[model samples]
Target: MSDANNQTKAAPKHSAMHIAVGLLARRDYSRQQIQLKLQQKQYDADEIETTLDHCQQSGYLDDARFAALLLKSHISKGHGVNKIRQSMQQKGLSRALIEQVLLDSECDWFEVAKLKAQKKYGEAVPLDHPTRAKCIRYLMGQGFDYEQANYALAVEVD
Candidate 1:
C-alpha cells in the first residue's frame, strides 16, 4: 500500500535549472524553445522565467550561438537564405537576430544553389519547359530565390 501510495504521488519535481541544463546538454535551444519546453514540463511560470534568466546570465543559454549553429547546419544542407530565415523565425528567433546572422554570413547563396542543382539534376540546363519548371520548383523548395535557381540552371555542364 505504501509503495502504491508513493508511486501515485508523482516523481519528485526537478529544479528548473536542472531540467534546463539537462535539455541543454542534449542540444542547443533558443531561449523561447527552452521556455516552451519548461512550460511543457509543468515548471512554475515564475521559476521557469528565473531559471532562464540565470542560464542566460551564466552563458549557458545563448540565442546567438544557437542561431549561428542552426544557420550553419541549414546552409550545409543546401538551404537558401529565405528558407533559413523562415526556419529561424519558426524557432522563435527575432527578425533582427535572423537578419543579423544572415548579414554576417559570408556564404554565397548563388554558388550554393548552383552546386545543389548540379548535384541533383546534373550540370546542364533543363532541355524542356516541363523539365526546367521541375528543376526550378526543386530549387525553390530548397529555399533558393528565383534568380539564384534560374542562374543555377543556366550554368554549363562540365
Candidate 2:
C-alpha cells in the first residue's frame, strides 16, 4: 500500500442505518455494545446517536428480546441458572428482568447444571475433592456460582 493511503486520516463513513441493520441481521448485541462499536468505527457521534434512536423506535434494537435470546441459547447449551444469569448480566441485561425471565421460563436451574455435569464427567461421577473442584470451576467459568456448581456436581457425584 502507498504511504499516503496508509497515512490517510479519514475515518470510516459507513451509513449509520446500514451498519445498524447489518450488525442486527448478523447477530444480537447489547445496546451499549452496539454504541461502542459505532464509536469504535468512528461514526459521527450525532449520527450514531440518531441512528440508534431511530433503530430502537423501529423495534430493531430491543434489550429484552436480546436478553431472552441469550438466555435461551445458554440454557440449550446445558448451562445452569446461575451461569445463564451471569452471562446475561455480563451482556448488560437488567438484573430484575433476568430474574423474571429465568423464573418465567420455569427452567429447572439446578437440573440443567446437573445434567451438564453428568454429560461431561459421566455417570461414574467425580466426587473426590480434586475432581469435584475441577467440576465446580468449570461450571463457574460457564457462569454458575459455587452453590449451584456444588449442587449440580453433587446430584451426579453423590
Candidate 3:
C-alpha cells in the first residue's frame, strides 16, 4: 500500500474546452480567472484563448454577470461598496464592468451602514468617545469610508 501510494503518475491531459466546461459547470468564472485556471492546468495559450472565446460566445462565461452575482453576495454579507469593489478588482473584473454593477445595484450606503450598525451596536449611538471610535473603526474595517462610518455611528433611534 505504501509503495502504491508513492508511485509517480502523469497528469492526464484534457482539451481546453473540456476543462473549461467542467470548471464552468462547477461555478461561474470570469474569463481571466478561467484562463489562469487553465494555464495552471498546463493548457496551451492559444488553446486557452480560443476556448475562452468560444465559451464567451456561447454564453457559458460572462464577466458582467459574474460581477453582478459577486456584488450581490458581498452586499448581502454586510460588506461596504469599497470592499466589494476591491474584491471585484482582485477577481480581474474591469473598471467599466465594476462601475456598471455598482450603478445598477443602486444601493443606499447610508441605510446599509445604519442597518449594519444597528445589528452590531443597537439603535442608540455609542455614549463614550472610545466606544464611538471603536464603532467607527469597525465600519471602516468593513470597507466603509470615514463619512459612511461616522454616519453609521451617528444613527439615532426614532
Number of the top-ranking candidate, with lDDT as the measure: 1
Candidate 2 lDDT tens digits, 10-107: 66666978898799888888787788888888898898899888888988898888888988898889876777887888777788888888877887
For model 2, give the 10-residue run with minimal summed lDDT.
149-158
Alpha carbon lDDT of each predicted model:
0.92, 0.81, 0.88
Tens digits of per-residue lDDT, candidate 1, 1-158, equal: 99999889988889989999998988999999999999998999999999999999998999999999999999889889989999999998999999999999988999999989988987566779998999999999999999999998894657
Off by over 4 Å in 3: 1-11
lDDT of 2: 0.81
Which residue pairs collide, candidate 3? none
By lDDT, is 1 or 2 better?
1
**TM-score between candidate 2 and the true structure:** 0.77
TM-score of 3: 0.89
Clash list (residue pairs), candidate 1:
none
Tens digit per residue, CA lDDT, model 3, 56-154: 999999999999999889888788989999999989999999999999999988778777888988878887999999999999878788898888887
